[model samples]
Target: MIDKQEQSLNVKMYINGEWRESSNIQKRSIINPANGSIIGYSEEATIEDAREAIKAAREAFDSGVWSNLSTGERAEFLFKIADKIIENREELARLETLDNGKPYREAEADVDDAAACFRYYAGLITKPSGQTYDVPAPIQAMVIREPIGVCGLIVPWNYPLLMGVWKIAPALAAGNTIVFKPSEVTPVTSKKLLEIFEEVELPKGVANMVLGAGSIVGNEIVENKDVDKISFTGGTVTGKHIMRTAADTVKKVSLELGGKSPNIIFADADFETAVDYALFGIYAGSGQICAAGSRILVEESIHDRFVEKFVDRANQIIVGPGSDLESEMGPLVSEEHLNKVLSYIELGKKEGAALAAGGSRLTENGLDKGYFVAPTVFVDVRQDMRIVREEIFGPVAVIQKFKNEQEAIKLANDSEYGLAGGVFTQDGAKGLRVVKKLRAGITWVNTYHFTFNEAPWGGYKQSGFGRGLGTFGLEEFQEVKQININLEVEPIGWFK
Candidate 1:
């Protein structure tokens, strides 16, 4: 239970259109990462509770109450949800900041982005249906897309609400009933979103939320035979586990896993813009982003200058509580994550990388009680070093120099994960050429971490399969069927 001394929040699970406590009567504390305060508590659902959510989704899908609605009708509900998000943007943003330890401004932006996602999907749902093809003889053929029954959506803690919308909006717009599992670490905004769902009068069992540990709640979502598909965003290890478990039921799975994305800067690039983006790429979200450009491959010609500028900027970042609004960076999400990041920093030092700036935890002033880490930068990093190769998921960046464009491409593609990469070059032809060579799914030419709802987002190699956002994301929750009709029947001579 959360301490009554701090602010209290409602943290009930939404199952079958009702907000209720966990069946097992267990609860988990929700911490405010900014100051290590107990902000709220959530129902810790058991496996049985998870099964109930799944059953609800299954029944809803079978009922066809939501699935049978016209595309335009479904779009209406999504638009309403978007409207509600805008109406309560500040409140939702504050809750997100409190739960996830991101700056209030960033959390607000996430709220707006989430609303935009729903609106985008709303417009998309009404645009197209399927394709009709002309066939030889008297047969007519066509392909149609239909909902894939009950969907299980498991989202992570970093961009809690936005990631939830990313999965839910598309799943709902595709006309599939959903059972969403938000990370136990940050379930505040998700519970609030369900409140909006109730306000919008979303049909019973059409959308459900189960709050608990991943081992129980998430496992139920993956292994349950009733769930037609599972869309997961988390670490690669957990993703692999979901894949293995879902295989028993042969459920359709779409995973957006980990990344060790590369941000390459060439000497010919705009120096100031490249440097700023390099910092933004890694430092934004405290480097907790899956697409955080943790690996920086700089052209050897400008390596010294870039590192100098980058370090100067990183040192100037104000670290404090997310609610301060004046602070540029906030604390890590939890004590455990902070220690994990510190361990990685130590590993980087032991592996012989030079700490350029901001390499240790900050406990100055009132920040001692918070999980704050200084924006750390390391130069002279080797390609094979753990700091350079792994996803630290902190505000840490490693700088390595590449001699030429060929070497830049080689180093960028050397990773087992290929979620995203960026190349900064002023030459248009050279930028396109390098972009084509990068193995990542999403690559920015002169920009670093800009993503739009209209563009496809996913990765190659071990970064996981399938796509999210844009038209492709909508298609992930749908199944295609080919329908053929014969206008005339003819008997073969051999049959007579």
Candidate 2:
């Protein structure tokens, strides 16, 4: 059931902390995943509108109005933004569920996570320090951390508000202005957030939003010379394009991109726990998460038993409307994404991987309307299969068998992506030892999807670089400045 709490909020792009209609002022229907109804529409942003957002953010940054604020003062405002998010969690969560086609509880939890991110960075900025060192007998050198200036933040649709918070909070905490673009598929929750600070808000151009496709607004934002830094989280191809666009001006860039993460099960592992972890990693968030554990590497001894348990749990996943709350899996972000994920299913079968269960869309259960795909499991998949090496980005798991710990590590490390992975074992020591060899940014022991506000998050290899959370994440927004002063009243020039 679509909640009545989803108020009819038709919002436009928020530029310069002011909500304004695009000159195009056009709106596109946002589908309700429950029954695929047109629930709401968002005002589309044009290239001109994107330019305006960039101009505003650049103006705010160059003027040093927001950037020059004291770290303590900036931290206070950051907390104020966090407080605003906490105050409206329910309404904002509801908006998130409607736009992103995710379960309400998870959406609500993401909103809470979003709030915690801001609060964490709010406290973190106050602790940022620069080095004070002796330069000579008469001179001392002091280094200060300064804001990097205007930031261009491009977020993905899978976790709209969460991704937004991940980038926005740290950018603001580091005393940088921002020009952000939320994915067009899910802008409702983002818009509701803009409305949170109607009365007391950040400096006028401190935070701004542009709405449009990546081909349009994103290109404008990332390529603009006024934009000092570009932070993006999306597919690898798009991230590469963003990086290339930033090259002209040599703007600072950070990208958290694609993943084909592996979930490895050792023969010495706890079977039940491994099964649960493997199931959740591939199926949670409807397998829309960038870190979704898509590859399953099992030891040869327990491969049969593990696949049985994993397939059983995967079979039980209920594919229905995200509004149902009880539904364990929801639709893909859009029809195109659904088709793309579906096409991979066909390829998996053709590549000689055995389809264990749920090979097609859920046209049964009167769910012929929404973009619903059945939770799928492919067994006896070779390491060479496309299903084993690629990111399906759907509720599909490909099971591959390995002979020993060494083989498991080699097979897991064979992928082009290394965002996240998990290891299961009964011996705690062995589990810790194997995680060190996995070559992934985040490693889980006896579980999957373990995340927190304090831990840094990013990926290795094709997965992209620069952490998105924790102290390291915030540091990405700053530039180091060193100052040298001559204590001796004598002039110092080139050792003269």
Candidate 1 displacement at residue 409 in angstroms: 0.6
Q: How many residue pairs in model 1 have overlapping backbones?
A: 0
lDDT of 1 at 233: 96
Q: Candidate 1, residues 323-432: lDDT per residue as tens digits?
A: 88788998999999999999999999999999999889898988888999999999988888999889999999999999999999999999999999999999999999
Best by TM-score: 1
Span of ten consecutive residues with least summed lDDT in model 1: 1-10
lDDT of each residue in 76-123, candidate 2, tens digit only = 887887888888887788778777788887888998999899899988
What is the lDDT, from 0 to 100, of the residue 221 in candidate 2?
Answer: 87
Error of 1 at 484 (Å): 0.4
| Estimated TM-score for each candidate | 0.98, 0.97
User: How many clashes does each candidate structure show, in the order listed?
Assistant: 0, 0
Candidates in order have lDDT scores of 0.93, 0.85
